[model samples]
Every structure is written in C-alpha cells, then in structure tokens.
Target: MKRLLIFYFLFFPVFLLSEKRDVYAISDGKGNIKLFWLTSPKNYPSGGWRIEEEKTNKVIEKQLYCGREEFLNALKEEEKGLAKNFIKIFKDDDKEKKGKKFLIVLEAMTNWNFAQAIGIGYEIKDVPKGKVRYKIIGLDESGKKVGPHFLSDFLDSSVETLPPDAPENLKAEIILREVKLSWSQPKEKGVIPSVFFNVERDGKVLNLNPIIPSGEDSSFLDKEPPSLMEVNYFVYGVDVFGRKSIIKKISIYVPDLKGMVPPENFTAEEKSGKIILRWKKVENSSGYIIERSNLSNSLYEILTPKGIQPDMEYYEDSNLQGGSVYYYRIHSYGRDGKIGPPSLVAFAQAKNQTPPPKPKNLKAKVGRTMVQLMWDRVDFPVAGYRIERKAEGKEKWDRLNEKLTPEPNYNDITGLYTQGKFKYRVIAVAYDEKESLPSEEVEVELLDTVSPNPPRITNIESFDGVVKIYFEPSPPEEDVFNFLIVRGVSEEDPGLVIGEPLSKEKREFEDKFVKIGQRYWYRVVAIDKKGNRSDLSSSRDINV
Candidate 1:
C-alpha cells in the first residue's frame, strides 16, 4: 500500500502540470499598460485567454491573447497610453532562436502617492519547458522615472533581491563646527549603489551634487560659510536606485567680541643708557605700542606699534645718553578698542668718567760716580716708581729698581766701572700701577780718583754643601770696592773667576762652589775707602 501511495502522488503532479495553462506577458517599454496571454489547458478546452490592467478599479487596458498576431496588436494598443516614443515587446520564439529570453517594460502608475507612482512592472510566464513552469517579476524606476532604459525583470531566481521600500533611517550628523556632516547610505542588491548628499545652510541649499562612489564613506564637507549669528541647514542622502531619503536639519552659532572691555598689565624698565619696556599680552590683543620720553623733556616717542608677548618681560632703550638720566613707560591695546594704563616709572643714570694726566719735568743727573734720577710728581695717586738706565751705545736698557719709593728722586750709580759712560732715566707711576713714559736720559762718564789695595785672603769655609772663600780687606776704612776669583784645573794656568761687586767699607767677601781637587784663582781690587777699585792682584789658587 505504501508503494501504491507513492506512485499515485507522483502521477498526480504530472496530471496537474498537464492541465496548467502557458501564460505570457509583455509591455511596450513605456506605460502602465501591459498585455498577457494564456494558452488554453488541454482538458479545459479553452482556445485562448484575455488579460487586463486596472487602476482605481477602472480598466486601463483590455485585450485578447492569441499568438504573435494578438501579442503585437495588444502592444500597439498599449503604446497609445505611453508618454515616451520607444516601445517594444519581446516574444518567446524570437528569444529562443537568438539565445535570449522574454523581456517586458511597463510604465509605473500613480495611485495618488507621488513617490510610489514612479515605477515599472514586468512579468514572464512559462519559463521552463513542459510540466515544470516558473514566473519572473521585477520593478523598475520606482522613484523619479526619467530615464530611457531600466531593469524590469530577473532572468534567474538566484539573482539577489532588493527591498521594496528604499532605504530607511537616513540621517545627517554634524561632525564639527565647520559644517562637516555624515549620513547612512541605501542598501540594494544586484547593482553597486551610489549615494549623493545635499546640504542646505542659511535658507539656501548648496548647489554642488557630489556623487559618492560605491563603498566609499558617506561624509561631506559643507565648505560654504553660513551667515553671522545662528544658522539653519537641511541635508539628505540619495542612492543609485533613484531613491532619496528624508531630510535632516542642523544649527550653528557664531559669536562677536566687539566693544568689549580689555584688561591691563603693562610695564617698563630703565637700564644702562637705554629704556626697556614690556607689557602683559591680552587674550585676544593684536599687538602693543611702546611710548617713551625723557624725564626732563615733554616729547614722547612710540617704541613699538605691534603689541609684545605677555611673557616677554623686558625691552631695551639703546639710545639713551651716557651721563644723563631718563624715564620710560609702556601701553597695551586690544582689538576691542580697550587701552591699558601706563606702566610704573623707571629711572636710569649714566656712567661716570675720570682719567689721570701724564707726569712732567722728569730729569736725570750725575753726582760723583752715581747717577741721580728725578721727576715731578703726578697729580693723581700712584704706587712706587721704577728707574731705568743704559750705558752709552748699548741696545738694551736696565731697570735699576724693581719698585722704588713713591718719591720723585732716585740714586742708582752702584755697579758702574771707572772710566765708563752711562745713561739714566726715571718713570712715574699711577695708583693702578701704570708707568709713565721714561724721563729724559742723562749721559755721564765716571773717573778714577784713588786706588785701594787688595785685601788678604782669610777664613776659607764650607756651608750648606757649598764652599765659601772669604777674604778680609786690610785697613777697615779702606775701600775694597771690587773683587775677582778665577778657577782652573792647574795652579800655574789658573783661570780668573768673576766676583760680584761689594761696598767699599765691606771687609769680608764669600765665594760659593769651590769643588775639591779643582784649583781656583782669586783676585781682589780695592781703593783707600774711596769710590775707586785697585788693579788685580796676582792669582791665589785654592785647592780643596
């Protein structure tokens, strides 16, 4: 019984398929009118069927369906109601040979709603051969039906479908004060959709209609500036399906600060020979002006027109007098016509000056064998001075005293040879230790008056790792003015050693560095306690 039941179910579908009619529908590509025909079922015994379209319950187009003859006649009648000239009807036989399929185009009819009226509908029946059948249906130009060619039907059921009500929740978001806005795009199938956004500000909509590419961002920049004060605007989004979303509104506010009171905090200062000024920067101040004047004068000068930075605490007045005093002040201005009070008074004094004059009447003289130097005192305070002398025809001058008395006179005649000519000069010095130019030079020659005999050698000793050769001049009053010691390897050829100069009243003299086994030569010259030296005595060789 189950096998029989399965057999009957399969056979029942075949019988029903055989009794089904083959229907075909077509449009003239332009109107609300459509033509449809149905072949009579074999058992039903009807030869053909008729079709009709109605609006507001009134028939718009009624026709009988036959073969190609009836299809062409119905298409001609429908064309009368179309506003556009291009009209066509596709047939099954024509599509089969050309590897094409039946296509229909129908005009959209308005049922009182303008947004809903702008659409076209098409239908295709008997798609598959024999017992199996399919119908294809679609909509075209549902909004703003202005174009010539549009999609009306789907060839396959697997093709993606789209929503019938366009996109919902279309909105505009004002992202910033610069009139930047964003919106949501429409969702559709089979075709990549494009979006367009319109912006309106200050009662006038912007003329730029920007097309948003597929999958691109849905934001826009409203570069057009709005009016002063608060502004109003409207925005909307349009999709590639000729569908437009609802409008959105936005408001913006702009402020003014004119005629407002400005604040103050300006200041100034006085530095070396200059006036420096500065002021505190106002929040919106364009710039500041600096004015200056001498405390004793009435004329004031503007220093800087552009306001200074609030943190730039100081400025310089590089043109002030060296010994004169000056005063300075500063002022600040703002864009709101506000003026700041003058800064505190600042005073500056110039520097002092006092320079020393040169010395005068410098002279040098010779007394006996000593050279005497003298100079007039300088009016200014001074440290001790120096005396300089040079022998006649010598290239270098010698300093007699490193730093002598503050007095103007000096006697520097020691260490001079008899019959030798010499020159002498003096220099005056100031408290800062600055020395004046040298005094006028005086040249003099010394003459031998008397001679003193050589003293006897005595008291040879060694001290501090050094050998000291001492001698005593005979007759203490006699002047043993100068002495000489010479050293050599041999006594008979002993070389003379030079000795430093000594005073005439001195009795003893010490010679340093007498090495053992080395023969040394000694000679002493003396005058009878006078300003003279005796002839060299025969050499004395000392061995240690």
Candidate 2:
C-alpha cells in the first residue's frame, strides 16, 4: 500500500505574513538572501524556521531552536556574547559549512518586552533563482503546544535589489510659479527594466506619468505644490521589475507672495559671519520685506518682520550658521499693507568667523567587549571627526581613531579584557585638515558587560544513585560567582538549573535528582561575578 502526505494550506492561514516586515529579505545580488527580524516578547521556549521551494512545495532546510541552549549548540562559540554574534550578516559560502549556528548578538542591549529586536536569523545562501517561502514560528514555554505567534514570509529570489547609488545631485529650485526638480540621468540610458524616473509628492506617487529626457537631465514639475511653503519630495528610479533605486529626498520651498516684478540688482556679499545685502529701489514702493534661508531647502525667515523702510537700501544680517549658504530676497510694497512679490534670490556663502564650535551630547552604550559612543551632528561643515581616549589616572590622551570617522559614532575596544576608568573626547576636522577644539570629556567606569567563555567538559561519571559532571574552568576562579549543573533528557534541552549554584572553586557538581531506569544528559554552565552567564558546554549523556 502507498501512503500519501498532505499539508492543508487553510489550517495555517494565520501564519501568512500580512506585514512586509514579517521577515526582512533583501538580495545580495549574488544569489543569497540577507534576512533579519524581530524577536518574540513572550520568550517562547522554541523558535523555528522552515524554508520551502514555492513551486515544488518541498522544504529544503529547517530548525527548531528550543532556546539559547539549542541555538548555541548549533554554532561556534564566541566571547563577544550573543547580541553581537546574532545580528551579523553573512555573504559567502563559509557560513554554510557550519550547519547553521548563530551567536546571540544582543541580550542586555535590548529590553525584550518593549523595544523588541530582530537578530541572529538564518544565513541562507546559494539559493536558486526563483520564489522561496520561509516560516518563523514562536512556540510557548508552558509545555502547551499553543503558539504566541507565527510569521510566514514569501521571498522571491528576486527580492527587491538595486545598485548602491541613487540618481546623483537631486536639486529643487523655484521656477516661477512651479517647483522644478531634476537629477543626473542614468549614465547608461534606458527605460522600464533598465532605469526610469518616478515622482512622488508628500507620499502619493502619480499613477499617470510622463518623463521627457532632455540632454543629460530628466526633470519634473510639481504642477500643484500644495499651497504650502515647504514640501518634502521623495524621488525614485524604479525598473519594470518593480525594483527601485535608492530614494533621493528634496525639501522645496515655494513662496506665497510671488510673481510681481521683483527688485533688480539684488546682490548679497559674504562678510565674516554676516551677509551684506543691497538692491536697487523699486519705484512707488514705500517699504519692503527681507527674507533669508539656507539654500532653498526650507521656508525663508522674514528678516524684516516689522517691515524695512525704503531708506534702508542695505542691511547687515549677522545671525547665521557657520560654513553654510544663505539665500536672501527683498519685496517692495505700496502704502497699503499688502506685500508685493519677492525679488530675485541672491545667495552667499557664510565664512567661519571663528573655529568650529565644540561638539555636544556625547553618550556611550556599554556593550559586551566594547563601548559604543554617539553624539549630535555638528552644525558646521566638517570633513570628519577625530576621537581621543585616556585611561583613568593617565596624564596623556591617546588617539583612538587612526583616521577621522566620517560618521558621528565610534566603538572603543580599549579596555575589553579589563574594566578601568576611561575618558573620551571628539573634535571636528575641516576638509583643509584644520582641527576644532575638543569636545567636553566624557568619563566611563567600565564594568563587566561581557560574559565568561563556555567551559569545557572533560569527564562525567554516575554511581550510588548520583551523577557527577566535571568541567574545566575558563575564567579566573575568583571572578566566577557560580557553576550550574544542567541535567536533561536531551542534551539540547536548556534543562532546569538543577541543584544549588556551585562555587567558583568547584570544577564538578553531583546531581542526586534522578529516577531509576531513566536516561540523563548533563552539561555545565558558568556565571561571572557581574551576573553574566556563559553558554552551555558541550554535552555528555548517561543512562541511569
């Protein structure tokens, strides 16, 4: 007799992923998927994933991770703890040989109940060029088969992939009553599956579209810029396959009072920290309104909130941000309060009157082996930033970053093995290599943010109705707070923390909690003084 197996699709309807974020999938362009997703808040005892061919409906690979124990046992052990190891993105075939092990990337870094996390997912590689469906299930801890959640994601081998660069130099300028937006056309000209332009306003994309390429540029006009002064525009270049280019954003400022013959010869000159503006007077106008802004990205600030007298032909505007462009315009009005159209826009670059200002809001996040730092962006133009560190009680400061980091954050691994008092400072560097004053020093007393390494089990023995588990200590004996003996039916089960948490000096523990004619597998777990737990040691099984 031939037996048949079947999976009813209707029974698992709730597992269907209705959200795009169920499992984030992106193609590396080399036939592999880069995936990551949020962790469960319910602390499911077992979480699993299954990958199946969409058309053939055949499962290729799957895993049922009962907890940290099973997940750790499946992968290589690392000293950096679970958080860093969990969120790593792999691109090559080397990871495929490991039989699927994921290190815990974060533990203390996230509060599991609130700000949930998505990390340590499958490193699926060398996938065929077609549709692949994946399922992630969260099983309960109470021994009830009830599931807290199930996520089913459908990923095509063609997962929304695109080239790194978006259209270059996106510009938005005021063209009379309309706003003109344009970008450099694709170097290799094409349409549809190649590269085509799409314009989106506020957020809604225009369904009926038309693109006319004129020379090296393609442009679009926001026929109706919602009677607003400042509008944000997101521009994309999508192909026929629906894959999109990196989104370029533009903030366009459309003036309300416009179109009347503006003042002529309106000119602005850079003078230290201020811009000096002068313009020819318009006949029959008694007063004028002066406005200034950063380029054309934002609404202009009215310089003459109380109206400038016609006699004031020139005004000195000193309130400005360092190393930035300032655009200015003037409007003339009659005896009536009605304001006339704005004049020709004049822009000038403001110079750095003094040196760059001090950086602010320097903060640190203590990680397993390193401390990550972040600070607010400097308002002035900077080539990059330099970071310096000094050990507590040390008189000299040591430069930590060899090269100026273009980004505002840095990771300091300097006291990784030992906890100490450390101080850090940051400075801005101009493109000319000139340096700014160092920011206020931030001091941190490093703690044991890292866990101890997994211990190695050498021998196990059973006699007199008791089981003895022996392991070699990996951390300094004094730093170890205790050792836990985990006994389970299966070595992979993160079995109960049995017996008392043993002292640091003991390399072995005896377990008397057992039943006759039963089987048990034992493993060792260690904890450091600061309460960081080590991974479960390799297992050894014995029959009672």
Candidate 3:
C-alpha cells in the first residue's frame, strides 16, 4: 500500500553517492526487474546487509546470489580485477530469529569497504510488474549505522518500466566531413522531469555516458564521420533508472567544402503587427527559401516571392490571422542553386496587434472627505481602467486603485488632510494589462465640510461632595475649534452647554456650581473648523 516511486535522478538520484542506502528498482518491458543500489559507507562497520520481507519474515531467494561457491560460479562470465571477501549470513552466538535463506548478497561483506561502487545489475527474472517489498537493513553495530538503515520504513518499490519520453526535433547539420547533432528536450509529465541523452552513429554509441541538455538543446559534434557515404545517427533519452526512450534516427550524407548547410538558431516570435522569423547567417549562401504552414505536419506554402537575399537573415510575416499559430521553416541555397538540407521548424502565434484608445472625458467632483472620480467608459471592450493621483507640484503620479476599476468611477480618500492642489488621471487598460496614454488631467482643491467625531466622557468623579468630569478629545485635532460640555438632569432632557464652551485643549472641568444631593449626566461635543457639529458623546452621570 506504500506508494512512493521517486523518479530516480529528480527526487532521489539512483546513485546512492551519499550515506543513505535505500533500494531503487526498474523493470524491463519484459517480466524482469533490476533492483540496484550501492553500499553506504555508514554500513562498512555493520558487517553485512540482510534482505528481509516483513510480510512472511522470509527472503525472495531467487533475487539474490549467496555464498562464495555460488558467487564465484556466477562471476565466471563477469570481469573481475578486484577481489573481496565475504562473511557468514548470521552470527553464531546470537540467533533470536533466523531467516530461512541467505538473503545477503556476496557483495554483502561491506566490512572491508568496497573500493569500487557495487552495482546490482543482476536482474530478478520473472518478477511481477509491481509491489515488490524488500526490506534491506544493515546489521546493527552500535548506533552509527542507524542513519542508512531505515528499519521501520519498508522499500515498497513499485517496479515498472516507465521509460522517459524521447528527445524532440532531432536535427543534424552536416558540414563537410563532420556532423553536428542537436535536439530539444522532451516534454515529460511524470515525476522525472529531465533525462540525459545518448547519441549513436551507425548503431555505435558516440558518447560513453549520456549527455545532458545544456541550453535550448542537447548537441554533440561528431567530428569524424564517414566521407560522402550516408551515415545514420540515433538519439535517445535515458533516466537514472537506465530505462531508455524510443530512439530517434536521422540519416545524413556528409557535404563537400563548397556545399552549404541550413541556417542555425532559427526562431519565431510575435512582434508589432507581425511574427518575426530569424536565423543565424549562413556563410557563402546565395539565397534563402521561406515556407509557412498554418497546420503543423501539413504541406507548407512558400511565403517569399522569389528568394530572400543572402545578406538578410530575418523575415517578418505580417499577413496573419490574429491569435493563430504559424509554423515557419527556412533553408539556404549555395551558388549553384543547390539547396542545403533539412531546416528546423519554428512556430509563433500572432497576438492582438493594435493599442487601445486612451480613456476620455475625465472629471472629478470635490467633497470634503474624498474626491469622487468619473470618466466616460470606453466604448470598445477592455479589461478595466486604472486611476492615478498626483499633487499640484509633484511630477510623479501614484496609482490610486490597487486593482483595475470595473466601472468608470473611483473614490479616493487618501491624503485629504493637507488642503493642497491635487490632480487625477485615468488610463485605459487592455486585456493584457497594456495601458493607453493617460486621459486629460483634471485638477481640484477639496472643500472643507467634514465633521470630527464626538469625544467620550470617560470618568466623572464625585469626591468631597463635588463633581468633576474627565473626557477624551476627538480628532482631527487640527479641525476641532473647541469642546462643548453638556449637562442633563434626565435621559430625555436636551443637555445645556456649560461654562460657554471649554478650550479646545481642555479635557476636564470641575462643576463647582452643582449643589449637594444633585445627580447629573455629562456629555461632550466637538465642532470642526467649518462649524460642523459632531453628535453628542455617550453620557456618564456623577452623584454629589
């Protein structure tokens, strides 16, 4: 039931170069599986490794080669320069539990430490495609071996041949006697995102190890190829598991010194009103032929009238349907109208070509608290509009709306305190967030009509048979003219303002005029500089 099939190199590299020793598995298309791993240095002192299955506490005997006698006979065919010793499967004195078979491999004697890394290329024949649970544990010696030995976690390896995709668009550029091969990486959807490539010439591998893609392509230079004769080259992708993709083959005849090859680094991209196609200039080429195709893998139509001059390496195709993908391929011609071989196909999609018209009829309505902005909505379809604000003398304009405004209106309240000249502008935005020129700017100075919130009468103290009131001041402190302290005898009574209106800074007052045995509720009111009165504050009663 444990299902974690790490795609070898990407998640955990199949090469256990580090100290961890977990088993990795891969299956051939046939019913055979190869379980491979290197012995960790941490297990060198652990004497040996034992493969135990948790289900039956038994060993899959067919998967392992046991004993010096059996290992020597099996190695008769395999080359052997280094000699290693082996130890017994189990210790004599301590035998609490003993597995039936010697699950330990002959490479199991990790004590001396392997000079060369051990590979488990020995395939387990006739093994099932999935669910092969093998628990490889280091014989515990002290506590150092604990790092590599995953005692609790089972190696529930799902062994199957999930080969990586083959490299795409394999191309060969034949120059005289040399052949240069290039290929784009395959689009892989599995956990394994990348693979090293292998190139073969005439069924012989050119590279000993697999080659990794460098930039846009994986390339190889076959400097020495057969002269004049057509030689076939093959390229394939291989993952860390040693599983390979279907090989892509290309046949090429080495060209002479006078012969020209196709242009290199061919690319296509969408520019203003056209899809631009470009390629590196081919030396000594007379002319170039350009062909375009709307559908991939279909017949192509020559887009050029005669042929593009040798000096020009770029062509712009302006006659295109918007949002349609177009494929282009180009090849160069030598002096004798000898067309060079095989050009790479590149494609690009044309986009919406024109800019949207700028927003119009911008206007601003001034209010004391905020400026209400409005503009004539764009008649053409657009994503939305953006609002930006600027002060009178400031050259930089800051955007007021965080997101595009769906409607043609916005309310801005920021920076209204400073009574200064402000300017507003609206920009029309395209679906791709492309902005049009700013609308005609509108300038306005805000009017003063906002009122300050009422202050709260916090605590009213009655000590020594006298009542005193303490209140908190309301903001904006700059706008408040003064505080109005009101006194009321009952809930329904209209409070009377006491001591003509207190100073703006004053927050408390001693009510010496209150007679003994009198109860009264106190309230506070704030008036802004524009004479706008705030609502009365909640009342607090005092007893004398």
Candidate 4:
C-alpha cells in the first residue's frame, strides 16, 4: 500500500465526526468498510457499540472488537479460530442497500471499563462542509456504567479527497490602532482551490464566518485590537468543499503608554547674535514651548508663542542679553494643553558686540575676465570676512560675496564686462556678527594693455665675420610698435643689448661686429604701444 493509503484515513474520524477525534473509516466500493477505532475493554458484556440511521430513526448493533495490539498478538489458536466466526457476525445487515445514502452514526462506549470514556460523532455528507463537534462523556468510572445507545448528533458522511496546503509565511505587525496580518496563498496545480479563510485569535474564532479575501488579496487588518497583552493569531485556508488546510500562526505584543515621551538630544548654541535651540521631536504632540532662565535654577519663562506646529524642532531667541549666559528648558504639549515632562537644561552664552582687528596687506591683480585678491589671515575667533567693491569714484561699496568669505584670498569672477578702475575692501566679522572697520583699499585698473604676438626667427647664417639673421613677423603693424633684440654669451647670461629696439617693420637683423670662431645667442621681444611687453622669441645661435 502507498503511504497515503497507510496514513490518509488513519485519522479520518477526527476530521469527519463531530463528537470523536480518533475514530475513522475507509470503505471499499462494494459497501464493505475497514473501520479502525483505537479502543479497548477488559470485560465482554460491559462494553459494546451503537449506530443510528438519523433519517429513518433505526438503531443497529455494532460489535466491539478487542483491537489492543497485545491482545490481538497474543490470541491463541482456538481464540483466532473463534474471531473468524465473530467477523461474519460483525458484517453489515442485508437491509443496508449498497447504492443508497443515509445519515449514519458511530458511537463508542468504554463507560464501563476501569477507564471511563464515551464519544458521540456526527457529520454532514453528500459532500462534508462543517466543523467537527467533540465532547467527552464523563470523567469517572461510575459515569461510564450505561447500556449501549445511539448518539443523537450523527447526521451524514462525506467523501471529499483533497484539502488545500497550508498558507505560507504568516506575518503580524502592530501599528497605531490595529494589528495587521499578511500571508501568501496556498500552492495548487492550476487554479486556486480556496473559497475563503478562517481566522482565530488565541483559539477563539475572530470572524463570525470564514473571511472571503478581496480580489487576489492576502492581507487583513484587525481593527478591534486586543488589550495590552501578547496575542497569537491563526489563519486557515478552507477550500470550496469545506476541507481545511493546516494553520499559519504568528504572535505580537501590544504596548500601552500612559502619556507622551519627552524630547531628546536637546542642545543650545549662540550663532549670529541669536541663541539657537534644537531637539528631536516627539510624536502626537501639539507643539513645543521653550523656557529661558537668567539664573541657573530659577526665573525661567516661556519663550515661544502658542499654536506652533508639532513638527517644529528648532527655536531662535533673538532678544537675549549680550554676553550673558542663558539657561533653557523645553517641553511638548498635547492638543488638550497637557504638558509632558521638561527636558534637561541647556545653556549658551550670548555673543558680545566688540569686533576683531581688520585684515592688512591687501593686494589685487586684474585679469581679462577676473580679479584675484589676497590679504593677511585673521588669528582671532571671528565668524568670517566680508568683501565689498565699487567703481573708483563711487562712494558706496556694493557687497561682492553673497555670504561671509571664509578664506583670506578670493577671486572676483562674477561681474567682468564693466571695465574701469575698481576698488575693493574687506572687513572682519566677530562671533557677535559685528563688522570691523574696512581695511586699506586696493585698486586695479582694467584696460586693454595686452602686448602683440611675437615674431618667429626663421634661420641664421654666418659668413666670414658677419652674422645675418632671417625672421617672420605675424602680427599686424598697427598693434606692434617694435622688437628688442638682446645677445647673450651663453644660454643663461643676459648679454648687453645688441642694438636699440628694432622696428616692427624689420623682421631680421645682422650682427656685423663678430670675431672669428666666437659663438653668440640672440632672442627678440615685441613691444606694443601701451608699454606691454610680449614673451621672448625662439633663440638663434651663430659661430663666426
């Protein structure tokens, strides 16, 4: 026999009967049943079995077999022979037609045995779709001394073969007002066999009936949350034929709070002439109220106005006395105006108005598109430096930096098209946000003073004692005024001027005063009318 044959009906009574959990049966097609009931009795006449046809009100007799393993194993030869005859007597009566259906009952009576017990069972058939009702007859042996009789609860039997698999991965979470549960559907071959699910809490049925999931949903929320206690939940999938799957279970704890929790991470600092206070916010609060005290322990007063939002975490006290230490404490209130416990005291010193010394040795360099400025760094604990600029003749200096300049050097790269003399000044700002006197002004003139591009020295030749030079002039004559030719004994020496600056119109110059076997190096520079000088050209060498 297969394992399913061995185990499928091994515990069928528990699933089919309303009054007994251990009694079970399996039937052959010809109306013969191999029923198994795990029961025993010491005496013969004291214990028996009863069956009832609920629809016709007919009572039938069922023989109680001594199915104890030891008793069956130890049967003598004659006893075994007698059991064969008893099996014939125990067969169903001919009145029970094979093809007809009837509401039937199976009742067990171990009441007279030393161990008193009684079980009554019922089931709805055609296709079983209901719960199993179970009840113990009695607890004492005297209570079991009754005669055989039919149990009234039996009604039918079912032949359903398949039940859904258990639900997977059950989860539970406790939120503000509800306990949420989620689970995956059972695995099936083609389509879902589930008709609904039954939910339970601590073994008590929660939904009045099986809960039908909305289109393809797998989650449910329990709005009627349990009290402050650990609660267990169970979800069981029930198929269309009322076959139930194994249960998915989870447990969660619900917390009970008496009042609101206090704020956390409170801190205070003096920044930009104001006392800034901040702390982590608490949930479900109306707003936070800040208190200030001049003395360390007394004279605290509320500093915030009413009706502030609950999410605000920072407050600024701009009316603080300069150079004085202010102690602060904060508390959150609910919508009902009930205040929570006050936070730990925090203190900060208001900044003074005295400023640090001004920066010195300011310098400016003007470029085509930008001007770079540098100055001595301040050693005092100042906030930062402020840079301002204006036209040379303008009285008011417009602020150049959007915020305080944190470094000693800054590049004025914002406005470049306005050309002329520009004057700049920098001031040191103290922690109290007081600006010091402006440093000495630095001016830069922005005019077109670029020199013309240089010419190339193409080649040089020396014949006899005279050196002749050839060159190429690239820039227009209107931009270049002249070129200066200088000679050097070696590459590193800046020799005397070979001649006055050469005219732009002249591209080459001949050095006639050269001795035989002497070597010389020569370079030229182009000078424009604005007095701006270009870089030296490529060097040429001559040996005569």
Best by lDDT: 3
Q: Which rank order by TM-score, best down to worst?
A: 2, 4, 3, 1
> Which portions of model 1 miss their true places by more than 4 Å?
1-194, 202-205, 208-225, 232-234, 244-251, 255-509, 512-544
Of the two candidates 1 and 4, the one with more favorable TM-score, higher being better, is: 4
Write candidate 1's Cα lDDT for 213-244 as tens digits.
22323455665444235656676554323334
**Any idea what lDDT model 2 has?**
0.62
Best by TM-score: 2
**Pairs with backbone N, CA or C atoms under 3 Å apart (clashes), candidate 2:** 37-118, 82-104, 82-105, 83-104, 83-105, 83-106, 84-105, 86-105
lDDT of 4 by residue, 343-438 (tens): 899999998545678999999988777889999987666778999999978899998888888889899983534467889999988765767789
Clashing pairs in 4: 18-133, 111-144, 125-157, 517-544
Collision count for each candidate, in order: 18, 8, 0, 4
The CA lDDT at 217 in model 1 is 38
Better-scoring candidate (lDDT), 2 or 4:
2
Please identify model 3 stretches exceeding 4 Å from their true place: 1-22, 29-31, 38-46, 61-79, 82-122, 128-130, 140-147, 150-160, 175-177, 184-188, 191-196, 208-217, 226-231, 239-242, 251-253, 257-544
lDDT for model 4, please. 0.60
Runs of candidate 2 with Cα error greater than 4 angstroms are: 1-264, 280-289, 293-302, 305-312, 331-343, 355-422, 426-436, 474-481, 490-493
Model 3, 123-190: lDDT tens digits are 44665454555554544444222323432222223444566677889888866436899888776544
